[model samples]
Target chain A: MRFSIQQPALLHMLQVVSKAVAVRTPKQVLTGILLEADDNTLTTTAYDLELGIQDTIHSDDTNQLDVSTPGSIVLPARYLSEVIRKLPSDNVSISVNNNYMTSIQCGQVEFHLHGIDAEEFPKLPEFQSDTQIQLQSELLNDFIRSTTFAASNSEVRPILTGTHIQYTDGTLNFTATDGLRLATRSTTFDDADTHNWTAIIPSKSLSELSRLLPDNDTVIDVQLTDSHSLFVIGETYFYTRLIDGTYPDTSRIIPKVQRTEIRVNVKSIASAIDRAALIARDRDNHMVRLEVQGQKMTFSSSSPEIGNVSESVEASQKEGDDFQIAFNAKYVLDALAVFDNTDVLIRFNGSNQPFTIQQVDGDVGLQLISPVLMR
Target chain B: MRFSIQQPALLHMLQVVSKAVAVRTPKQVLTGILLEADDNTLTTTAYDLELGIQDTIHSDDTNQLDVSTPGSIVLPARYLSEVIRKLPSDNVSISVNNNYMTSIQCGQVEFHLHGIDAEEFPKLPEFQSDTQIQLQSELLNDFIRSTTFAASNSEVRPILTGTHIQYTDGTLNFTATDGLRLATRSTTFDDADTHNWTAIIPSKSLSELSRLLPDNDTVIDVQLTDSHSLFVIGETYFYTRLIDGTYPDTSRIIPKVQRTEIRVNVKSIASAIDRAALIARDRDNHMVRLEVQGQKMTFSSSSPEIGNVSESVEASQKEGDDFQIAFNAKYVLDALAVFDNTDVLIRFNGSNQPFTIQQVDGDVGLQLISPVLMR
Candidate 1:
């Protein structure tokens, strides 16, 4: 294979597909990226058995690409990336010899890298489906960010480590729960088809796709099957295998009735809890307690070995009954971070039950956290 | 002790002394910072047995320090620093109870921290010498930066892990070597006394002192005794124990004749070597060869498992016979970093002898590296 491509364009495509390169895979060939240059285009692909990515860069009127011969080769991802980053010119010329050794020349510097035969690389699994869903890249990225953090990271419960997605009534919904905390985020999509489907995607795959999403409001096509899912954005095709299991029913866990409701500025309460949490670090649960009475709210935590710390912040309004509850400081902080509004409403059913946190005026994004029992 | 101090001022003093606090010491009290608030001054001190630092902040015309009672107490350095960083007010109020428990209050937030008795803290050693040296903080910092990288980090040769300092004939000199490479930097101080002395300061201490030095050119007092060296700047007093041993005679190791000398642009050569070094990482010595013939220089490195890489750059001038030499790329890169001149002159005796790297115009700073033997 012989080809000359622009450095920036090639670098971007390499970065997009490089995420699928396995760190330490049983198959040694999976550590390299397959590159094929044919008919005024270069295609790059990487697969690690569970996840695969393929991106194509076409040489058109605006870009310059010259291909004298069409062939394929697999080069080590790390070495190729580092060499491209250190090249001295704007354009890179690469050619492969009969022995499968590739020569890369740019300005005054040249590198010869040993490459594996492209035929030895495993082929990417084919994904097909009759129903396709359309989503704005920004909105899909937002849904992943809001719910994925609540997913369990342990391998004991494999189903809980994936984000559950469903389509109903022209709305796309996402939910994730770790048995202790549940988060749900949804957005209306009028362009979605009438066919309803559900798939549990590993949280790790969704995060990587979110990072590769473009910064504009372009619409992308998504296809979900029983065994895999595919996301098509421009010339890039990202695919990940579906986690085969049933997610627990989390709708029954959200609180229905509240005995007390308090509205406080998000920044004010978050900072107050942060200070109290410092003293609570030496404790068993890292718990911080909140007491709401009249127009005042006080946050405090203590350790018998050290000492106690307390601070008070003003509450906008309070209803129902005055109450005190203890909670894991990190859970409360994580729930408070998703809201863009200045104030958030936290509802409590009792001192020992689960509570709900959401935006002060909207119910679209809701988070439920189970309170800790104080001794 | 009861006093109110500005938050930034207190934080600065705490950060300076905290560096001397031991992480895990047999003397548990050494982990706490001793605090003494007198009529118009607040003093903070920390000692790790080998190193001690004391800084004083006086309530003079420009700074405000209020002391209602004169007393002293010791508080855990880490906890105190963290609490002071998270306080909510601009001024911090601190008071000690009869039982030595300390209360810290800032605005609406308050913390009670456990404290140790101040009487158990170790006292700093006093150094009194008639001969004193004055150095500009910037100049001293430059000297430390140029030589410290050559110090050996192994404990087997403890003497090579320290920088040798000598004051003779109105000039101060510094030298450090790790057997493979040597670096020396010096400056002439016209006000120096006739008394001559030599001492080896641990590289760790010089690094810490360099960090505390002011950015501007401020004159600081320095005193060296048989056991310790003291550096006094403004209100801060820093002391470090001297390393006791005999340093090797490195002067004889430098070659006296040059068979070939080449001058090349520093940036061009450094970047070329950096690129070549990437391919040389798999080798045992990480060796890169420089072949200088006439006006052109070529840098190349290769491994049998990985392929080869080569690059060429122009040299301004070359004298004597053409030569090819191999050396550790990292050592050559490090020596090139200390020169401010656009071009550096490299002098070589032969392919097997040591080479010297320095600015083309001056001899005050010099670095020598021994070449690697090729098969």
Candidate 2:
């Protein structure tokens, strides 16, 4: 089919769906983006089997697009994006000539690219279900940040590689762990209706969706079929298949009580841990010990090759008894960076047991790290 | 060795010398920076054998340096840079408490790093020369811009991997060639020294020195010895060993005669070549053809698998006769970008002969690119 569209509008849609267009796709067709124009909208879709994205744009300048006939074609993603990005951002005329030549004309510049018939493109899975939930764009992005990092990245244990989501009545919960660290975040969804639902979404897909979401305070509609889940933000729709397996009960891995807890400024603790990490990198365990005595806490790490470091910092809380514990510095630092709080309270049950880190004021976000074997 | 220096001053020097310190050096001492403090001046040096840098800084708030005995110590470059960068930009106190204990204190943050005595560090080449030449910093930096890119970067061609400079009788000439392309620029020194000198300086070292030069019109001294060349700018003395063997005769490769010449606007020609190169990338030759007839020139390139394209551009010169020539579009564009003229005259002796790209109105720079064979 033949149709014309504005150059800038087409470029916008290409950027949205081009994320899934792998440079080294096993199937050559997956490297191309399928474009279709009908009525007053042009839709582009790209998929690499594991994940897929579709984006649509509405046009007002019909001259840029004149539908001599209605059909579709798959054009190379990278070349098209480059051509349009270099074009002047004015009214650009784009049309399919001879059902094969895709031409874009702006001022003195003209670009012509070869196109593949849309019939050869793989069909995108049809996601149809009634289980749709609403989530604020910012809050959902934060939820992904808080828990996605803990997901096991290895494909050997496919179930643990995904973040488990549990929802009931008016609340949605997210949990993930990579055996060394566990993270959980839950938020209230006033409009969430259908109760008792659980699904394991791949951490990678969740991160991609979080990065692509708009910065404004808009509501994103999340829907899940029996086997796949869809996240629709603005004019783009992102879909990924659910991990088919069972997730472990991580509730028991985090400590339920604490014998001693201390409140340390988030920035100070983060900086101290960063310095300790420099020395910890030379060690196989990458462990750093935190000793709390009264209101003064000391952070230290040692390596035979890089020598040892000991830093003393003050905290707001001192209680119970003096104690020292060692934990993986990377996991704890990664968890604390996502919080925008002044202070964080780290609780310890014993030197050899799992420890919990939470915001000092309230349990707005919770993170748990399993202690490593350290001597 | 004991000294206290402002964090910013130390960080700046670290950044300058760290450029020569490679992260993966087999000699452990090469990965560390040598710090030597005596009296009121603190000197720092970092070397990777082929290139080295020594910078001295004077500070008042850093105390009297308190050198009980003058000594040298080598410390890891990356770790020191990172630690100093994150520290507050105030006076920092440094002391050696034990044989290996190195402690740095600034505000409430302190960093302790292991250090090795500086006797293990490589000896920097000394420049012993009575003859010296001076050039404007801005001009030297700009000259580097006009020639560095053409130098062959492959280590196998050691001589071609460096920019060759020759000065005699007040005129200083710079030449570089990477086999496929050559760039040459010359300027007259006001001193009118009758001494002749030649040296091959690595392209990477020249570029680094160019970027670090102060942005002013001050004259920078160029001192050359048997095996080392020094560019002492302000408080920093940059040294790089000269590559052995004679540099190729780039002067003879430039064509002195022409059969057909065409003058075109530099910006228009650059843009067309850039666009045409996009399509030419699919072929090994990456050949883009230029046909000049009357005052209009056409640039065209195509692949059998990817369609073909031709665009018409305006030109000002049409001498001798109409002709067509094919050249690697990337090389042609790169050479054109180095020209500061608005319009350039492209001269060709024949369809397959090496061509010269010169400023249409000036003679500040000249670039030559060898034509590629097209099949």
lDDT of 1 by residue, A96-193 (tens): 98678999888888899898899999987776678778888988888888888888999899999999998877777899888778889887667644
List TM-scores for all candidates, in order: 0.95, 0.94
DockQ of 1: 0.65
lDDT of 1 by residue, B202-292 (tens): 8888988888899778988989888889999889999988899888888898777799888888889998998998888745577999888
State the fnat of model 1. 0.70
Q: State interface RMSD in Å for all models.
A: 1.9, 2.3
Against the native complex, each candidate's DockQ, computed on alpha carbons, is 0.65, 0.48
Candidate 2 lDDT score at position B228: 86
Per-residue CA lDDT of candidate 2, range A1-375, in tens?
Answer: 556666667677788888777678677678888888777677889887777899977656543555556668788887777776766566665667785788766666666788887888887667677788777888888888889998998987898889998887777899998888889988766764665678999999898888788766799988887788889988898988899978898877777788878887888888887777777863566788888888887888877777666678898876666878887888888888877758888888767888777887755568989877666
Docking class of 2: acceptable
Any runs in candidate 2 off by more than 4 Å, and if so which?
Answer: A61-68, A90-101, A104-111, B61-70, B282-285
Lowest-scoring 10 consecutive residues by lDDT in candidate 2 chain B?
A: B61-70
